[model samples]
Target: MKTLTLLMTMSLLLAFVWERVDMVRLGYRIERLKSDKVRLERERDELRVKVSSLTSPARIAKVATEKLGMVPPRQDQVVVVRLEPEAPSPTSLAEFEIKLAKHDVSRKVR
Candidate 1:
């Protein structure tokens, strides 16, 4: 009976050691995952900075003028337009005013 108890005690000790080893392995994996996460986050931050730089105003203007062949409007080619308030009775005068306003806004945006 004593030998049997000794063997049982030995088994329990071995089981405890095994559990400790598994816990240590899992801890290592967790640490590795944390390291990977940090690396990925850093890379993402770098990419975001790069994207912002590429989309900057100067870069966009350069691309627009050089790549797309866009140019500023000439003064003679430009016309002023205004928007007239809506009236219950629409008149050609009011419609003309509205058209002018829309053209003005469009020119300003460009």
Candidate 2:
């Protein structure tokens, strides 16, 4: 009976040791994940700053003038065309399709 009791005690001790080891491993994993999250958050902040700088109007205008040789249009160079609405509303699908087909043909000719 003593031998059986000793065996049970040893089994319990082994199970307790295994549980402690697993707990320590999980703790290490959680720490590593926390550090990774912090690093990713820092990287995200850096990227946000970079995007803000790159998208600023001053930076865009500088790059356009220096790299692309772009110039702003002068008042005399701008021309505006006023569009007139001439098409009557279609009452049926067939009428719409016919009008769409005519528009497509006219566009293709141009």
Candidate 3:
């Protein structure tokens, strides 16, 4: 009876120690993940700032003029075009009006 009780006590002690070890390991993992999250967020912010700077109109214009030798178009060289749908021809309009909401029915109404 004494040996059985001692065995149970040792088993319980071992289980408690294993649980405490696992908890400590999990705490370390959580800290590592938190640090990684912060580092990645900071990196993302830096990349966002870089992207905004790279895409800024001023930077783009400067690079275009300096690197690619591009120049702004003169007012005379620039033309604005407006697109409008073509109007139906008079003959087609007359044909459509002649057809005037006609639909086929199976039988004539009384």
Which has the greatest lDDT? Answer: 1
As for lDDT, the candidate ahead, 2 or 3, is 3
> What ordering of candidates by TM-score runs from best to worst?
3, 2, 1
Off by over 4 Å in 3: 85-110
Query: Which digits, one per residue and each the tens of the lDDT, describe model 1 over residues 23-109?
Result: 999999999999999999999999999999999999999988888766665665566676666764644464453121113335432
Better of 2 and 3 by TM-score: 3
Backbone collision tally, model 2: 0
**Model 1 weakest lDDT span, ten residues long:** 96-105
lDDT of 2 by residue, 1-110 (tens): 99999999999999999999999999999999999999999999999999999999999999988887666755555555544436655652323211111122222221
* lDDT minimum window of 10 residues, candidate 3: 94-103
For model 1, the superposed segments whose C-alpha errors exceed 4 Å read 73-110
lDDT of 1 at 106: 55
Residue 6 lDDT in model 1?
100
Instruction: List where candidate 2 sits over 4 angstroms from the true fold.
Output: 79-110
Estimate the TM-score of every prediction: 0.62, 0.68, 0.70
lDDT of 1: 0.79
